[model samples]
Target: MTFQVARMNEQESAAWLGLVTVCQLLPAALDSQLKQDSGMTHFEFSVLSVLRFAPDHTLRMTALAETTSSTLPRLSHVCSRLEKRGLTDRFPCPEDGRATNVRLTPEGRNALVRAMPGHIDTARRLVVDALTPEQLDALAQVTAVIRGQLDDGRPARGNPFA
Candidate 1:
């Protein structure tokens, strides 16, 4: 089988490049702020934020991986790091002893709460404040379309925001 490939035209190329820049820059900006203010990377913040909202601040490791759109190996590695810092605790899942569960500690919750204001400010400065309300709504709709396509056929994971 063969597939045809073509170069992007001017408008398409501009739109694609803009999307790529957002993908590359946004996370780095978010991470930089989180790391500087909270000593946690954005991914770490994200994981903690998810766990903070989980039932009893606890979830099976597999469930965390799914919720965070993370690979098991990467999630395990991060979980180990969090454990070392006493931000989270990992234990045998009661429902399945062979599986693991992670719970956020009080310290972790404190860190997340402290990080929240700065993170929100960074997001607003970089994105929300940069766009008009109409543009923001349009951006959300467009991204939702793209995200839906990307997540198609996967289990639906709630947004990491509270």
Candidate 2:
């Protein structure tokens, strides 16, 4: 028996390289912007955004981890930082005494609110405005297809990586 590797064609290689580059650079760029403007990382901003939309601005720790695509330890560390900054609080989950829940505090909400303008501007400058309307639509569809492939049975959302 022989093992063979199928190499990507020119177009496929370009696409793959572009995707990899975007994956590598985009987060760092966004993280840098968020840290400069809001004193938070992109992941932290994501956590606050998730909690802000959650019921009563709260979510069980596990749920938060899933929603944010984080491990429990990472979530716990980020939560601790957020808690220290008065952005969020962790406490016993009311429905389950054994589990914990994190709540977005008023300070957290305000911080998110304050962070939005600069974040949106950065997003526009880096991505949104860089594409035409057609390109944006195409990008969304292409990304959804890629995410669907990567996530398997998981639900889809707007550029979870971003």
TM-scores for every candidate against the unseen true structure = 0.94, 0.95
Native-to-model Cα distance after best TM-score fit, residue 53 in candidate 1, in Å: 0.9
- Taken over the whole model, the C-alpha lDDT of each candidate is 0.91, 0.91
Superposed Cα deviation of residue 79, candidate 2 (Å): 0.1
Model 1 misplacement above 4 A = 1-3
Clash-forming residue pairs, model 1: none
After superposition on all C-alphas, the RMSD of every candidate to the true structure, in Å, is 1.6, 1.8
Candidate 2 lDDT at 131 equals 96
Instruction: Judge candidate 2 against the unseen true structure and give its global Cα lDDT, from 0 to 1.
Output: 0.91
**Weakest lDDT window of 10 consecutive positions for candidate 1:** 153-162
TM for candidate 2 is 0.95
**RMSD after Cα superposition, model 2:** 1.8
